[model samples]
Target: MNSSPPLSNLLRLAAAMIIITLSVYWMIFLRGLLVPILISVLLSILVSPITIQLEEKGLSKIASIILTIVLFLGLIAGIIYFATMQISDMLDVWPDLKRKGTLWFTQLQNWAYRLFGLRPQSQITKLQEMSMAFLSGGGSAALLKTTSTLADVILIPLYMFFMLYYRSFFCEFVYKVMAKSEKQRVNTVLFRICDVVHNYLSGLFIVMVIVGSLNTISLLILDINYAVFFGFFAALLLLIPYIGVLIGSLLPILMAFITKDSPMYGVGVAGAFLFIQFLEGNFITPYIVGSKISINPLVAIIGLLLGGVIWGIAGMMLSLPMIAILKVVFDHSESLKPFGYLIGEPVREESRRVVEEHTAENPELITDEVADSVKEAI
Candidate 1:
């Protein structure tokens, strides 16, 4: 018996893997350039309805777009100025903060030793040695990293401006190139994607602002230093999903521990975050975002991890929206609908069919004449 040839299949599989690897690498490597543009475009899309509304009110489209950009820029500038002042104040008291942190850690070590019958002094000594090594090498590296970050900060706004300016043309181009049957499908999917993204971003923004303001107020009440900085930092991180809340909550609690001289204050800070996130997830998000873009929690987590691996912070930030858009496309396509169903929220098809049948049985219910009756029955 002749054995089936295996080399060709192996070669094809190898080529496919290589192509996928290269595509991932390309996305990551070009993120430095593409990220700003992508962020700008997404922001523009989010705010486009406002721009259109302004135009309807008498302003030209170009004028409205320009006004929107300027307003956003001014808001950004104010935030930067406020955060800088707060951070500067924090830095000015850094030596005192460091001393307090060391004392707190020492106390924690002693407490742990007392409770667990472990040696605390040796662990503390090892920590000191590690800190010294980090200061000698990691500190300089961090400073260099900060410098590079500042450079990107300067570039992002410029990219945002140009992207917003050309947003209309880009949208038109997307619609223009598709065939008739494909065009309707593409347009429907695109509109749904845009709606979901816009709603999520806008709703999240509002939630963050409220949560951040609450955090700031709580910190101020507790007489914590850098309250504003921590509040804003938390708000920014709130743009990410489940992981963002943890990070946002941890930073403020740590700051409370370091600056307030009370472990209770740190606990209080964390408690406040937990409470706010609970309210937002259960109440605010449900009301504002509704059931539009529901995806499987497992898939969302996987997407976030994959995005982080591919594009670091920006990837993590954009991951959900990107997955959401993909879900929309998959849901609308016949071939890929099964994948979409796997990622989507559960729906009761039989219940929908029952409703349709009920509506068909009552002619007046199908019309506006029995709208109230239909609503009451439902």
Candidate 2:
């Protein structure tokens, strides 16, 4: 009988594993369809306040949503224009940059040969081969990829429009479908999800602007070419976790190495970016974004890896916010509250302070007599 119980448990575990595998496969298969929808939903939530404000100002619902979308598009266009101008300036100097880069590469190759006995000709040959391979294979693939992206870009605004238009219908549908007892809980969860998404998106944008400005000012001070481009490029890459800033910093460092007379300029560039990165991680993000999307590092990293596996870069960008929304839902659910806690930032200082202040007033509250109260406060 005991063996039967163990065997049954094993089967149940296997079943769960199978279901999870299938779910992952399904998501991968539907990625093209899903990415736009997910982006649209986030965009809708981000602009919900604008829509609401417009409605309050006596604009019709449809008109409000339309104006909000137009304003959003205009903002996106302005950013694109700014980036394009920066790119154009770089393109104008591309030939000179390439010549300098080639000269630097030749010098590095000679240095490598002297230090490590590596053949410089072999390095050049490999580089030529790789360039040839990319030229042969990348063109058609690039064109098709661009076409696919354009389709998604077109679909996203349409999705956002419908989603906004039917937002009320969806909320009503949820309430209508749920049991009366659960309606209150569902309503709370829906609001929490909206709030989390809105705050996270808005706060992230503000942080990006602040980080980008800092990056630009630092690079300009360093007299780096394409300072504005590199700065905001790095800021945009902040959407990716961990390595984004590193990639961002490397470009300017490479520029320093190519254009500047001294290697110390490269070192200076690296130092500047590292300092900005430190500020962004420690002071900037924490202060601006706050604890609204307070995902612990471990959980956030794991979610990011999983997201990358499922949907590449877009998935990675979406993962943290999605995890935050999930945590909110989990926190409100009796059965899943533990999982929410597991995902959350660990033992926040504010929570600790609350506990200490409460205990000072009533030390008995911390004792076994009221352990649940202590736990709740934490």
lDDT of each: 0.76, 0.86
lDDT of 1 by residue, 227-290 (tens): 7777768877867777787787787787788777568999898888788778767887666654
Model 1: how far residue 44 lies from native, Å = 1.4
Off by over 4 Å in 1: 1-19, 57-62, 116-121, 128-148, 220-223, 259-262, 347-378
List the lowest-lDDT window of 10 residues for candidate 2: 369-378
TM-score of each model, paired residue for residue = 0.80, 0.89
Model 2 bad stretches (over 4 Å): 1-8, 128-140, 349-378
Output the number of the lDDT-best candidate: 2
TM-score of 2: 0.89
Cα error, residue 356 of model 2, in Å, equals 13
- Global CA lDDT of candidate 2, please? 0.86
